[model samples]
Target: MNSKKVRILVAKPGLDGHDRGARVVARALRDAGFEVIYTGLHQTPEQIAETALQEDVDAVGLSILSGAHMTLVPRVKKLLRDNGMGDVLMVVGGIIPEDDGRELINNGHADQVFTPGEPLDNITDYIGSKIRS
Candidate 1:
C-alpha cells in the first residue's frame, strides 16, 4: 500500500439522483491510489462537510448535475469555513456551466471544475497536484 494516501471525499449534493459519474470518479480516484470516501446520492452541503471532517479528507469533490452548483457550492464552502476546515480543497464536477465554473472559483467554492467527459487522468492529476503542494 502507498504510505501517503491522498484522502478525498466524493459527494453528490442536492436532488441529483444520477450517480454513475460520481461512482466512476470515485473508482478512478481509488485506482489512482487515493483513499476515496463516497457519500452516496442526495447529500446536503452540511452532510458533505460533516463527512469531510469525520473522514479527515484532504479534499472534497462534489458531483452536481442538477444545475444547483451555485447554491450548493457556496453552502458547502460556508460550512467548511465555519468549521475551520476551509483549507480543505474543494473541486466540483458534472454538468457545470462555464459561467458557473468561473463563479465558483471566484467565490472560493471550488479550486477546479471538471465538466462531463473530462478524462479521469486529469481529475486524478489535479487532485495529486493540489494535495502534493
Candidate 2:
C-alpha cells in the first residue's frame, strides 16, 4: 500500500454564495484520509487551476449548486488542460441535471458528477481508486 494520501482541491465556482455543500464535502474528503485544499466560493477558473497547480493536487472536486456546471466545469477543465494539469482528476458535485452530467462526462470535462444524497464514501472511494491507479 502506498500510504501517501491523495491531494484534492475542492472548489466552488461562479456566483454561488451558498457553500454548505462544499464545506461538507471538504470535511468528508479530509476524514477519508485525503489532503484537501478548499478554494472557497466564487473562484474563477484561472484561480482554481493555478491553485491546483501550485498545490500539486492529484484531483479537483468542483461543488456548484448554482446550476452553472455547464459553463464553469468546462472552463475549469480547459484551464487545467491548457496549463498542463489535464491529467488531474476532475469530479463535479452539484445540482446538475442528469443529462448535463452525462454530457459533462461524455465531453471529458468531468470524470464524474455527483448529486445530492450521494454518499461521501462514493466520492472518496472513487477518487482513491482513480488516483491510486
How do all models score by TM-score? 0.96, 0.96
TM-score of 1: 0.96
Model 1: residues >4 Å from true position, as ranges? 1-4
| Model 2 lowest lDDT segment of ten | 1-10
Tens-place lDDT per residue, model 1, 37-109, is: 9999999888998998999889999999989889999999999989899999999999988998998998788
Error of 2 at 17 (Å): 1.5
What do the candidate models score in CA lDDT, each in turn?
0.92, 0.92
Candidate 1, position 117, lDDT? 82
